[model samples]
Target: MNKLLEVKDLNISFHTFAGEVQAIRGVNFDLYEGETLAIVGESGSGKSVTTKSIMQLLSANSEIKSGEILFNDRDIVKAPEKEMQKIRGKDISMIFQDPMTSLNPTMTIGNQIMEPLLKHRKLNKTEAKHRAIELLNLVGIPKPQLRIKQYPHQFSGGMRQRVVIAIALACAPKVLIADEPTTALDVTIQGQILDLMKDLQKRIETSIIFITHDLGVVANVADRVAVMYGGKIIEVGTVDEIFYNPQHPYTWGLISSMPSLDTTEEELYVIPGTPPDLLHPPKGDAFAPRNPYAMKIDLEEEPPMLKVSDTHYAATWLLHPNAPKVDPPLAVKERWNKFQKQVGSLNGGK
Candidate 1:
């Protein structure tokens, strides 16, 4: 796969009345062409901040303290606002979490989709309207011609999301960032949106950065997974590796917390303690406080990304050569074994 977007040691901080909140502390990742890379973590774990930086969409109070966002060899962090405008909806685009707020209540859906086409693609009115109808149809919104004229209020949550997607894909963006795109919909609708996005990716050949806290969604849509915690990426691997061989304690907790298909347990496993405060960022491993398997070194020093495989890396003291061998929780281990067995059987060998 072609390396399309590269983020290197990206540090982001927000200057608020409280203090400087170090939201992203030396983050790094890469996006490949025509692939979905899911950024998974807890709500405040810097998943959104990191991806938003790719589009240069951080707020006024936010600062890119360091690092580079390289898209097509162009440094996005250093790109001026005038240049960023061309990239925002043309080269890269975003689908926000809430479709309710993403769309304009007063504007017709057609005009909304056409706005980007006109601005970025510089299509005239007649050409833009034709493409708008095509996009509406492409996103599975029925009766593109008639539905195009309808306001955001007329569409259901799922339909509204399709419109939002249409707008995001207006210029056939090279990179598409879907930040919790399916969060606001029902289960059925969520599935539909996921299917639609996968379909669209194949059709348009766009690389995707999918940001979400839901590991289930990550499992469904991601080619690779980057698991973040306490504003840093604690683990990253191919989807199969992350699902079947996750190494980080936080990744184990996240997977174990999901409601199991085979288990009828009423209570889900929760990771103990709260996330660390970014205002005063931890001097050691950021996740040490919440990690049940945390060692003395975990509290004294930050762990580097230890190599598990060429495609897998995890930052934890447990991955150290001198550290004691400790297994994940029973639930996590069982799930991992089950996943391994499933893959082994599919490969027709042990």
Candidate 2:
């Protein structure tokens, strides 16, 4: 449980014609060695923006107003471009959602993977070429020798993703950020990719930051989960805690919305209302507008993150001592029970 990456009070904003969009507001989390942490939220919830800021990959209009991103005890936020270049692929790497866009269309797969080895490992042409084919094989690509010579367009979507993963693992980074890595694939392919990532993680012992909106995806790959909303984390806890004893309304909605694997539900539950606009952000709790359990205080004041357990924390008035106790929807409770049974079975009924 060694700490690999720490993001403290990280804030990111964008300068647009209309106004400054506060994309990430005081978000905080830590990734431990060989652990997978999933950041789950709806689109525009700052899931991608927060992680992108850590890599200094924000767009030209976006600005890092404040906060510290400490990687390996070094303040990466303050590091120069040259220093970051060395760290990007050597110590930390990212796999974007669309592999086709991320990969160079004109470059051969072999040359693309070899680029990192040549830049970071200082490998000669022959050495880099040999390692490139080895990486392709490592990612389960068939006929690595012939495949390496082909262009990206020659591969299928799933195969292209394997190439993207190969590039990310080429440098053997300590931390890997996967931003919706399996979003564009079919369900079966998505499961295979997720399993592959887990298997690779076990072999390499690398910490991963998995960003996605799919709770089902988180269930398989994540050790811990951070529930985000309106540019802030509303709940942070272990996978079991968040799944079994969720405290935030947002977290409850997300769990209830998950397509049940055990039950026959015709339609999936969707959270009501839309995410709040960041231009003129709410003065109080940003989620108040969409929260079904909102109280009078919820519209006038924001709640601080309350400690529910040693490792679990949630930002909601429902956890306050003076507030009346409430229960989540029946559907959510049912899902929690099913999830518990699954976990128990996996742990040999412990």
Candidate 3:
């Protein structure tokens, strides 16, 4: 697969009354053509901020300290606003979490979807209207012709999101960045949206960067996963590798916290301690305070990312040659074993 987008050593900071908050710290990742990469992390993990930087959508107070975002072999960071305007929707599109906020309340849904086509393709009113209805139908929105003329308020939450997806696909963008796209919908609706996205990807072959805190969602949609913590990508690998043989303590915590179909545990496991403050950043690893298996070196120095395999890398002392080998918690081990058994049973008793 060819590389569609590359983010190299990206760092971002926000100027605040208290001090500068270092949000993204040398984050690096790649998105290949027709592949889905999911960025998973906690609320303040800078997952959203990193992707927003790619689109040049950061607030005035936010600054890119270092990095290059290369799209189609061109550096987007240095691209002028006028050029970015042409690329934003035509080459790359974004779908925000809240469809209500993204769509204009006064404008009809048809007009909203048609705007991009008109601007990018220079289609006439009749042509744009016909394309708008087709887009709605493509996203699995029922009664496309009638729904196109309705206002944003007329659509339900899930339908509104469908509209958002329709508008995103208006120009047949090569890449789409969906930031918590299903957060506002119910579980059934969420599943519907995920299925719709998968179907669209199959037909269009668009590279997707899906940003979410939900591990469950990632399991269903992601080809690869990047676990973020304290404004950095601490671990990255294929979805199965990250789920089955996770190396980072933070990644372990996230997987253990996921509700299992086989486990009937009364209480869900939660990671202890809060994320480190960025204003006065930690001298060593930010996750050391919450890590039960933290070594002395974890508090004294930050561990560099160690390669476990060609496709898997983690920033944790556990993978270091000199560090002592310590297994994950007993509960985590038990959960893994049970999950393995279930998988074995499902795959023709392998």
Candidate 4:
């Protein structure tokens, strides 16, 4: 697949009265054409920051320390405001976490969707309005022509989210970044939203960067997954690689913590300790403190993202040639085995 966006050694920091907090540290990943790349991590893991940095939507105090956000062979990190304006909502678009906050309650839904078309697509009122209605229907909104005249307050939570998606897809953006778009919805609505996005991606052939803390959601939509910890991408691989052949301890913890359908265990697993404070970032592996299999090297030095396969890589001392091999929790192992068996059965033993 062709690479749509490449983020290389990206570093970002936020200035607070306390000090400069390192929000993203040398994070690297690529978004391929027409594929969904899910960035999975706990809060403050820099998943949102990384994506926001790509969009140039970081807060005023945020600083870009280094790295490149290469999109379509152009560096977005250094692009001027005018250039970013042209790119945003046109070439690339983002659906924020909250539909309530993302939409303008004062504006009609139709106008909200049309705003981008007028600004970026240079469509006149009549043309933009027609396209907006088309987008409204495209995102599964009912009576788009009538609903477009309604304010955001008039829509239900699920409907409002659909409106936000319509707005994001207004200009037929090549890349769509969804930052936990379903976090605020209930399970059923969440599933609907995800299904909607997957359907839209297929129809539009848009590359997506899906940011979420839920491993379960990643399974549904992601072709590839990047696991973040302490402002760093600790693991990057295809979804199956991360799920069934995870190499990093952090990855193991994340997978194990997720509820498994086939597991017989009564107790749910949880990773120990909280994420490290980034204001005074740890010198060693940020996840070392919480890692049960942490070796002395984990506490003394940071590990590089070493290759595990052609498409899989992980940052962990455990993957070092000299380190002892430690098995993941029984739950994780069981889940991996189940996934492998399912794959084997699907292939009819090849």
Candidate 5:
């Protein structure tokens, strides 16, 4: 697949009264055409910030210290406001996490969806409304014609989200960034929303960047996974590679913490310690404080992303050739084995 977007050496900071908060620290990743790339991380891990930067949606206090966000061979970070305006909704669109906050309560559903069509597509009132109803129906809202006339409060939470997705997809953007789109919904609704997105991906052929900490959701939707920690991508690989053959200790922790059907234990595993404070960032590996297998080098120097395979790489000293071979935690190992078997069984042992 061709590269749709490439974020290289991206660094972002927020100038605050306290100090400069280093939100994104030299982050790099690629989003391929027609692929769902899931950015998994704890809150404040720079997942949303990174995607937000792609859209140039940073706040007044936020600053892009340095980086290049290449989208379709154009560097968005250097693009003028006029150029960005042309690209925002037409070329790329984002579905925010909360529909209540994203959608205006005063406006009718049809008008909200038509807003982009009018602004970006230069459609007339009648044409935009016609497109809005089509979008509503496209996202699986029954009786869209009738529903379009109503306000956001008239629809259920799931329906509200569907409306939001419709608005995001109104212009047929090449890339869609969903920032924890399912975080506010219930489990059953979450499944429906995810299924809807995957269905849309196939029909629209648009690349999706899904940002969330839910590994379960990642398994359901993602083609590739990028694990982020301390404002950096600690590991990145295909779904099978990250889940079955994780290299970074942080990746192992995340996989092990995911709820498994094979596990009978009542208590779930949780990674210890909070993420590092970015104001006074650590000198070495950011995850070293919580990593049980961390060595002296992890405290003194940062580990480069060591290639584990053609498609897999992890930033951890443990992946170094000279580093002593150490097994992942017992719980993690067991969970990986169970997941591998589960996947194999599902694939008919092929």
Candidate 6:
């Protein structure tokens, strides 16, 4: 696959009244053409910050300390505002988390979807409206002609999300960034939206950057997964590798914390301790304090990403050649066992 977007040595910070908060620390990753890449992490883990930077959507208080965001051979970080205005919705589109605030309640759905078509494609009103209805229909909205004429309030929550997706896909962007687009929906709606996105990708041939803290959500959707923590990508691998053969301790914690419906346990496991303080970013590994498998070296130096496979890499001292071999927690092993058992049963007990 071709490299569509590449982020190298990306460092981002936010200037606040308290101090300069380091949001992204030397983050690096790649998004290939026609693939879904899921960036998973907690709320403040910089997943959104990194994706926002690709769209140049960071606030005025934020700064790109140093790095390059290469999209189609163009450095987006250095692109002027005028150039970015041309790139925003036409070249790259984003489906934000919340649909309620994302849409203008006053404007009809048709006009909202047509806004991008009018601004980017320079289409006439008739042409734009035609395209808008087509978009609404494409996203599985029923009676596009009548629905487009109605306000956002007239539609259900799921319908409003479909409208958001329609607007995002209106211009046929090369890249689509979905920042936890399913976070607000129920499980069934989430599944429908995921299916819709995968289907749309096939039809449009657009790369997708899916951001979420939910590991279970991306299981069937993502081709590759990047695990973020303390404002950095701690591990990255193919979906199968990350879920079946994780290397990072933090990754193990996340896997163990997944809520299992088959199990009788009602209390979902939580990763203990708070995330690292970025205002005074740690000198050593940021997750050292929280990592049970951490060693003396973890507190003294940050570990570089060690290659586990051609497609898998993780930043942890435990991956060091000289570090101690620590076993993953029993809960994580049990979870993996349950998954394997389920897979085996589905395969006719093979």
lDDT of 6 by residue, 1-350 (tens): 99999999999999999999999999999999999999998889999999999999999999999999999998989999999999999989999999999999989999999999999999999999999999999999999999989999999889899999999999999999999999999977987898899999999999999999988777868999999999999999999999888999999999888766576666567788999999999988998898877888888888899999999999988888888888778888777677666546644788
lDDT of 3 by residue, 232-267 (tens): 999999998888788999988987777666666765
TM-score of each: 0.95, 0.95, 0.95, 0.94, 0.95, 0.96
Q: Which residue ranges in model 6 land beyond 4 Å of their true spot?
A: 264-267, 337-350
lDDT of each: 0.90, 0.92, 0.91, 0.90, 0.93, 0.92
RMSD of 2: 2.4
Candidate 2 — what's its lDDT? 0.92
* Model 2 CA deviation exceeding 4 Å by range: 261-267, 336-350
Give residue 118's lDDT in candidate 5 (0 to 100): 97
What does candidate 2 score on TM? 0.95
lDDT of 5 at 300: 96
Who wins the lDDT comparison? Answer: 5
Residue clash pairs of candidate 2: none
The residue-level lDDT of candidate 6 at 80 comes to 96
The digit string of per-residue lDDT tens for model 4 on 154-269 reads 99999999999999988889999999999999977998899999999999899999999988789779999999999999999999999988989888888777764455566567
**Superposed Cα RMSD, model 1:** 3.2
Candidate 5 residue lDDT tens string, 1-350: 99999999999999999999999999999999999999999998999999999999999999999999999998999999989999998999999999999999999999999999999999999999999998999999999889999999999999999999999999999999999999999987998999999999999999999999988788879999999999999999998888878899999888888766666666578899999999999999999999999999999999999999999999999988899998777877677667667657755896
Q: Which 10 consecutive positions of candidate 4 have the poorest summed lDDT?
A: 338-347
Off by over 4 Å in 5: 261-266, 336-350
lDDT of 1 at 39: 96
